[model samples]
Target chain A: MDLPGIVHRAGGALLGTLQHVRIPGVGQASVTDDPATSARRWRAVTVLRDQAAVGTPEAPPPPLDRFGDRIEVRLTAAPADRGTELAARFRGTPSEAEIGELRAALREAKQLLEVGEVLRVDPQPHGQRKPTPQGAALEGMTEQAPKEGVL
Target chain B: MKAATWTGVNEVSVEDVPEPTILNDHDVILKIRQSVTCGSDLHLIGGYIPFMRAGDVIGHEFLGEVVEVGKEVRDRKVGDRVVVAPFAACGSCWYCKQELYSLCDNGNANPGITEGLWGQGVGGCFGYSHAMGGYAGSHAELMRVPYADVGTFVVPEGVSDTRALFASDAASTGWMGADLAGTEPGDVVAVWGAGGVGQMAARAAMLLGAEQVVVIDRVPERLTQVRTHVGAEAVDYTTTDVVAELRERTGGRGPDVCIEAVGMEAHAPGTPGIYDQVKQQLRLQTDRPTAVREAITACRKGGTVFTLGVFAAMVDKFPLGAAMNKGLTLRGAQVHAQRYIPELLRRMEADELVTEHLATHVMPLGEAPEGYRMFKEKDDGCVRAVFLP
Candidate 1:
């Protein structure tokens, strides 16, 4: 399926010098040069639409294509030069740090659109709850208890 | 800034932590006025709901004044008094559009952990563990609120901070339970546990036009509060056979609706309680379903069982046969605070929902560790603890 104009721009700006490559399970990664920017700056868009893409366009298609209705990840690099330009064009002028933050934000945005929310992790991983006998017993004592057969 | 942070299991300390800043365009920073310890916090501090990290600021029910707003924040501004819900929901998501804010698709920053645990991710909650969303909680002087326009509601005039505070979680959760249970005219509703949520659920049942609301609790003070303040009949489960008593109270049929407000960490009185305790202690089960089991068994034929408490994982002895045989419907959920906050505020403004009695212990933020201890131990009849920063 042909990528949308915005997707083309985002992919080109985010991933430098796109190429057509097939990765197992993730579907196709198609690289195309952006006409809006100079070729010397390595301005190219790489769209990695998943196999799950139905080919029917949504009103506003998801930020990242879905992988089997669950997992979604953008695995390409766009150039920093066009990244700033695109950020200013759409999200207002962002600082360099914000531009750096934008990539992560876009990745999270894709996850949210595809899987309902972004995955979170503790700043520092504290291990599981203390497994004392009373603690374990009380752990099971919930009013809105989780259903059986789930961990 | 001094805030309460979780150090370890059953161990929390008020320590100096860096103040929060506006991290996103839609974020707002609040100067907290009042932050309260919820019953659910007990689960976190006790290490029931895993995913807490060392030094994680832990609190969700709070009221504060807006001190700063991000560039894209539209409705809220500096100097607005607001009560923020525990759960953070993006207003534009599929679940939020459907009025299921707790199930908001795009709210939780960390959905992978929850998806692994519950098959699908729920929404993000403040001061809850990373499994919910590692967002810093409200127990500090300055805190950042994301999606402020949707989750933060302006506390109207004439509603006291004490009354408005419970609206954040307890009141909203209880109201949602009653709403889900479909409490209607001439219906008899039995609520298990008379903590903040229980008391509120009992009151909500009455507000929603239940013919008779009975609150069950082993604690004398909670039972008395439910009867005297909520105007519901109180049943002391310790002193009576709860199932038999419920059947007798409802003319030999169970109450039309049963609401379980006491979450995981239920206390059972006798042999069955010990049986659940042993099974859970041996790592055979993740939930001690004393209240849930009882609710299912005691619910009238074709009645509804609503679980309002927070449950993290699996449970043993579910009694699905009883549910199936009697044609009973079971429903449970985390509170969708955004949907009910405005209406609850209206009720508080009119003095129709009394919540001041629920805040039995009001202390400074410095004494939060002590407050948590008292609340956890149920020391001196502490139903809820309010912390002023």
Candidate 2:
């Protein structure tokens, strides 16, 4: 499988590489209008797929439409040394349109520019992921509505 | 009925194991379909475990085909495929009622005694040593269990042996570790041992939602397996200061919960070369509790420390001060194997968990001694070795 592509980043745990940058009209709206960050600069959810090869040979790397790749996001507040985790919504997959943006966004997002393994596609899926029926094509696992007012 | 006795450490001459006859209405005879070794079995070999005698059938982890049941036993039958819940508990004891079967009162000297109740006491384990209930273990093809219906669990259909085999001990022990750790969603949890039990704890911790999981061990191959399969950040304690590394990963707070999977023979320096001088002595000291020390020191302040590994006897001079000062919670014990088996089976059915990777080595029962040595030496990826007897 390809290395886990960076879905997005911000502060604290989100402090690493700017792995992907999703800014398509729908993705942008998803990030800009998320309830979690309705009044913030960016409320984006960037998913870190366990591998570059999530679904099948033909399946897309995540942030797919089914799982809500349209995430809320935010750029970290200044002072890189402050060490706040940068986080993003870890759901869904990216469209073909966003993969390119993801690469560019990663180049622009590297805070240190020295973290060795930038990106690599995986040959197989790892862990508990299910394969999409159509070879590698996938819609990604849908997010369940949080049960009864819970996370 | 010929009773089986401990021959020497692990060498049991099953030539004269007693044929158990009906006792209480709850007794059942098990024609063992599968019997095997446990890490606790190692305690006997190391002579670290207490109460052991020569000629005891040394095994507590096994599943059986029930050949007979007592008049009082109704739920189980002659043809049932069952896994013994290593810890025996009387069905209605206080601990049994509360579901803490391992701590049952009215406890017998046999490890499989079933007087279930809350026990903050120090006592027995089945088929292990003299200290625990000294009931003969299942190294042979047949044995008997009292309170059979309550203590024996059914292995689910369609679940492979690789999955169900550990339900009796290793899997549940790991679950105990994760549960005691109070795993939180998105919490950073670090598991200190990557044996069968440690791997399960890490996976269980993930099922509970630890955002970043780290596994520390000395074996390069084992660390690789955990990283490639479970995706926990790997730390080779031999090459790095585990406590310092965990602090660096967690921004100095360390893991929310730290689990000690290495148990009594916790080798302090990960790479495993120097013989522990303490192991040479009968008495255990702070230096003897290497893994315990690592686990305690590595845990985040205010975090929970779970000891899934079993020590022969309690050790001394623990950084209990750290536990008290850090306000950390410490919990240790052999697992209540029966309590968690059904839930684990359900998760396995749902495709939510898989334990197949843990079987780094599998051999026929004839190589049982070799399997034990390899495991003790931790050669290759011998994290867990299963004997297909």
Candidate 3:
């Protein structure tokens, strides 16, 4: 990989680590779970629909169903008529990339079930992006944003 | 398409950016009519937000005509004149269901940055920054609005484009502060800024039956507008002791509700102001809480203090002890424009909410750089520099 490519990836990695840093007033509570435990834990999205309508774990929605037997999917009712909690976890210890994919898939599934379409942002509108390291770093952060969060 | 963009700190540039297209089925393309500069946009322009990438489009409050709509869109079509909510909230989200549209879970596509900063993702705001959603702003000839059914409101025929524009964000935000802060009839309400939002909040308070409404600001023109246009009394904080004045006016009870419409880059007079400025410049604090602190201090015992301003992060010396001791209720939110835009438009139709005076400077999109300069410096009595794209 080239120098700029490495720096961009480093910026993304920095964003990935931000969720784990515990700052009393500035940042929220840190996610302290070990990587293996974190990967094993269920990542869920609350879809504002009925459990039956969200499809069974055996036959989950499209992008989620793509994971197939490689992951375990759960469909449960959310309280107060909010929706159904669609959750998934890798059957085995998954790599960081796999977990990121899972996160994106769950978000997409929720959006598709609720709004009937997933929202898109890129290729919308913008001017020139000067090739500064800081701009690249921000681009890296935004590129990694969809796959990283408290979800 | 030509668009106004944040090229660098304290700089705005007009660039030939690609025109936006429908990205979601619920999205609509707007041929922007009037997009105004918001005070919150200053934070991004000054690089206080830190999330704005160079060349990012940067205006949110606007009125436009829909030229195109995605197939799934309902209640809106081509040729409809509309004022859109700043936040792109899916109507089906739990937060949106509760009328808290700004907190819609699915609105922001890139939630990680904000989830990391604030522990939870907020709904996306158009043209704010990448942290919000990176949606192109209204400062362009054309822009895309997501969740069109939920966020965009049809302008009543009688209301002028200039009158319905503020209903998008400033009016909605100000009304939210007054209503959520629980301004009651015969109550004394004090708002601590005379910017577009502050002036609107004063108007909202009066309409909500507050007996006496006082808007505080140092800007002579804004203060005059507060008295003349909003029909609220104005207080010049530079010459008056704000706390003392509120106490005196309210028969020593202080204001029943205090709203702070000034955000992180708040200006203050004298020593405390200097201290905040120095600390902010030195990076000890991210925001200048001068107005927020005063609001907490000046609020009556058991009164509510609502911040209608846009604050990014933490501030030092927030006067939490005073808040707790006085039993003050503190609240703040991004403008839930969808919740109040309808009624605000109706008020605009009746000519009760006058926002045309707030558009003190109006120009075409090509002159955005100069317009932003006038707005940032508060030069030429520029309340809001409205851009016709």
Candidate 4:
């Protein structure tokens, strides 16, 4: 195999291992597509940890490669759980979509374990269309205006 | 399907919209039988809430019959009549478990916008702006209700649609205000405004064993309703000095609990209201806080002040000194309807909570735009405009 193909395969294998290696207190969550998945393969991991020690773990910067692969780590405190929560996402290639899926699974698993349900909202991925105050009023009166849903 | 949609500031129209379908496993489609214009809807129609889009459907207080149910919905079935809470909640969330349904962590469909606006997102509310989770509202032929088992309550067989409809928002919110204020036996409770919410709060205080309840508003008709319908004393702010009158009525001590049901758009008769109006026009402040200011000033020392009104953003000249010096306890929240709806329903069933008087004007759905105008103007003794679809 070509050198580039070898490196890509090696990266994919590393991500696959990272996806399943569950740390104590942090479990594997469900996987879902990130809104930006189409532009760049992004994956996230949610970790449940002691509230005080949540962000203690220093996140290493996204690993760089010739294939334009990257990873980002984030931590947020759960409001009611009184615990530390960690989420990580990676962007890479040669099975990047698979890695993204795995990351989503991990995030969902963490939410389920901590909150007991997957948070859901309508995915307005296209973002909001800025409405002019006057234009919005006119559009609202029109019968052909597009309808938006609360997910 | 025809739905009352927000066209712009002070603009609403009943327009043809697409029919809602069951989108999730726990979802249900409801054919709306009755919907009401809530005071909070004024904030949306007035452009006080920035997250509203041009074509967003508006009207959250509703009673409907379930026409379809998703596979995951276990408790509700088609043909069952139900009243939906204004806000959507995911029952398994930590907040929901604690009975804080309005603060459900996972309910907002448009969390990104809300998180940006409030530094954190709240649960989704029907027909509210996108910040509250842009779910289509109930002033329509049909609406898709997600997590149906958690958010909907089956109407009792004997409760009329008019009486049952207030349970959806106004009654529940007012009951919650009294509940938060810790209304007790022999305590004097004062409620500001005589709108649907204000009337409900006054009635709720009476139900909670308050010795006396007083409702304040400018409209003579509403005050009359307060006196006759809700069995509470009424005060006309325009004709009398509110703080002075409150002090005199409470034996010079002031009310034990003061509830502010008049929200951001509060108007003071004199200079303060004019000042707030000028500031609001210049984008200096978003809320007038006229009633809240008076509520704080009129509350007894060490008394509890319950804010049941909806204030979207910051207001100028809040009397923090009175709150601090008087040792007053101030609490406010969106109605966690799920926590209080069942109990309120029980009260309704027992004929203790009468809500039919609040729905003074009932009209067809097609005249919703006119309804909004009349309700906004408070014309012809219109407390609430009920829309029969």
- Number of the top candidate by TM-score? 3
**Two-way DockQ contest, 1 vs 2, winner:** 1
The clash count of every prediction, one per candidate, is: 20, 70, 0, 12
Alpha-carbon TM-score of each model against the true structure: 0.77, 0.66, 0.98, 0.79
- Name the runs in model 2 displaced over 4 angstroms: A1-151, B1-6, B9-18, B110-124, B270-276, B279-287
Q: After superposition, how far is residue B271 of candidate 1 from its true place, in Å?
A: 1.2
lDDT of every model, 2 decimals = 0.74, 0.57, 0.92, 0.75
The TM-score that candidate 2 achieves is: 0.66
For model 3, the local distance difference test gives 0.92
Q: Residue B167 of model 4: what lDDT?
A: 95
The DockQ value obtained for model 1 is 0.05
Q: Please give the DockQ score of every candidate, comma-separated.
A: 0.05, 0.01, 0.79, 0.07
Tens-digit lDDT string for candidate 2 (B39-61): 66776766665344454556777
- Model 1, B168-236: lDDT tens digits are 998999999999899998899999999999999999999999999999998888988997899999999
The parts of candidate 3 lying over 4 Å away from their true place are: none
Local error of candidate 4 at residue B120 (angstroms):
2.0
For candidate 4, the lDDT comes to 0.75
Model 2 deviation from native, Cα RMSD in Å: 25.0
Candidate that would win on DockQ: 3
lDDT of 4 by residue, B173-241 (tens): 999999889999999999999999999999999989999999999987899999999999998888999
TM-score ranking, best first: 3, 4, 1, 2
Candidate 1 chain A: 10-residue stretch with minimal lDDT: A142-151
Task: List each model's interface RMSD.
Answer: 14.3, 26.5, 1.1, 13.1
